[model samples]
Target: MMDALFITLQVILAVIAVYQFVFSLFGMYRKKKKAHFPATKSFAVLVAAHNEEQVVGALMENLKNLDYPKELYDVFVICDNCTDGTADIVREHGIQACVRTNTNLRGKGYAIEWMLKELWDMPRQYDAVVMFDADNLAAPNFLSEMNDDLSGGARVIQGYIDTKNPEDSWITAAYGISYWYINRLWQLSRHNVNMANFLGGTGMCFETKMLKEIGWGATSLVEDLEFTMRSVQKGIYPKFNYDAKVFDEKPLTFKASSRQRLRWMQGHFTVARRYFFPLLWQSIKERNLVKFDLALYSVNVYIVLLTFLMTAIMGIDAAVFNGPNIANIYGYLPLGLSFVAVGASILTFMAAMALEKVTFKKVYAYLILFPIYLISWYPITFYAFFTQNNKQWSHTEHTRVVRLEEVVQSKQV
Candidate 1:
């Protein structure tokens, strides 16, 4: 009976791993097709910056170059408690920019909320409200694509975010690969199947009415995720616009990466604790299994923790629990199947990378270093759980300058 129970447990985990692998494969295929939407309406481009003077100038330049009517789309920059010349730089560009300073509310979420409130009070309502970080340099046709998606009945749209500095260091390369894999496999696959896609902090466009109806307030450490969950509950699944692109810098140092990831993990945990139960209950009450599946998947940190614990327990069982005389109770079949599941997962990841137009030469270099990069996250995840860290926004420095010419050159080589 004990042997049977062990086999059953292994089978369950293998099944889950297989399911995830298949989902990733689907994403690999769906990423190749570009979904083009027609640009038909006006938009409000909103940015929240805090001590980001270095990149604000270039960001404004990128925004100014977007293929949208200057009169139809307005750029609003909220300089949240910036001690630098962030506001002055925007003014220097001869653009109409709003600068808000608040030392009390120091987070990007609060800054965005303040700006949204101010915009809401205006006599004219924009057709769509687009959100982006100050460091992000949007593609020239970003607004045009998002405008098309918005007009095509998409309540919320999420675009692809690629790293602007993949060659800077190993850390940046790993981050770039992770971002590429997510955009190609996770987001693309989920969207192809009509599953929910989460907002990626920047490069997201939302219908003005939906934004206002959802209160346009962000209080969680991960306001984007919290807002996404709330939007899902209201029957709005974020749509993925493949052609809408945003380029941003990845952390060059491990310390900076850990700090940024820790905040993200903490915010994810906080959102899970606050909303998972409520969403699960609502899904059950309304008989909407799809939403329940999304809510459960949205809080994926628990799965990682659970998998680690399970693997550790299996290791201990092999070393400490099993008697020398007793034949290994858990059959090798289950163990072998588990490894197969892992293999399939790796294949799915690689397949997704291929679909994202990642060349074999580049992927080979990343594959050799992927294990070390993945292991590094374990320490960060551990610290995120145990540390009683302040929830204050931890900013990452972005110094990389990437132009379209550089990207084109890399692609050719």
Candidate 2:
């Protein structure tokens, strides 16, 4: 019975691993046909902020200087429950700042919903709505690329997310490495195979009519994910635009990163529980492969928990329990496969770094410790599962004030 149980767990994990591995194979081929379109779509750029006085000005400057025409896009900042000078800063840039003071209805999703209603009531009509966090620095060509994508009939779009302070600390470096890996292997790979692209909280765009039709109902901690699942149910797949880039500020310390990820996982658990069955049923009813893929994607945190549980059971049984003495190599299959998975992850990280032109010397120490950061997710997943009922939103403070020019110049070096 013991041997059989071990084998069962091993097989389950192996299947999940294989599923992810197969999808990753598609990431290597990222050649997308380009459609040339005139820049005609008008965009209402929305920035949601909670006391982001320090970095909001920089983002304002970045937005003001977008390579796209000035008449084509307008910027609006939603200052939600902020006691700081964020509104003043927006006014300083001559941009309209919308303030919201609802303590009960907080979080980015609620703020977005409020702003969307306001935009809908206003006289100015926009073709599409672009969302960004106040800490982000948009690429000069960000709006132009998004315009092209909108013209190509993509109702929702997610741009490439780049790191601003990758070399700030080990934690930031690890975050940068993780984002780079997922952007290429996960997002680009899914897009390559015609799968749906998940929306990053920042760098996301939605067509005005489509968003209104879907309704701004996603108000969870991870609104981007919640909205993505909601869109998938309606057969709306967000397109990934590699040419459009947005530089995001990463937490510089482990404590900050931990808080951020815990909130994310907890929100992930909430989303999974709420949407798992609905997505699976929709997929079967409609025979939509994208919905099926999303159903699996929704339970990614549970997969992590399962991995941790299996590793613990295998280790405890082999060392402390010592109940099974099968003496067969099959008992060690999980261990062998784990080592292979780690090796593959390292290779994936190296490849991602190379593609992003990150020098080994600059990030070698952080790269060495990346596995440790990855392993930390197990405990976080467990904690998040237990505390999944807590829907309180905690803010991750972003203080790195890097300019768009500085980021672009560093990449060119």
The RMSD of every model to the true structure, in order and in angstroms, is 3.2, 2.1
Candidate 2 lDDT by residue in tens digits, 1-413: 86677667667667777788778767776685788688899999999999999999999999999998899899999999999999999999999999999999889999999999999999999999999999999998888899998888899999999888888889888988888888988898999878999999999999999988879899999999999999988889988998899999999888898999999999999999999999999989989889988998998889899878777766776798784553333455688776887788678777877775775354567777888789999999999999989988998887889998787777666
Best by lDDT: 2
TM-score to native of every candidate shown: 0.89, 0.95
For model 1, the stretches where C-alpha displacement exceeds 4 angstroms are 1-13, 31-38, 312-335, 360-363
lDDT of 1 by residue, 1-413 (tens): 85565556566656666666677766756445454655668898898788788888878888888888778898888878888888898889876567777776778788888888999899878988999888888888898888777777898999999877777777778888888888887788788888888888899898998887778666666888888888888888888887788987889887898788888877777788777888888889999865786677665666555556555667677699873322233354578865775677677657666777765355457577876777766666656666524577777777666665566467567
Looking at candidate 2, the ten consecutive residues that score lowest on lDDT are 323-332
Q: What is the lDDT of residue 330 in candidate 1?
A: 38
Clashing pairs in 1: none
**What TM-score does prediction 2 earn?**
0.95
Error of 1 at 60 (Å): 1.3
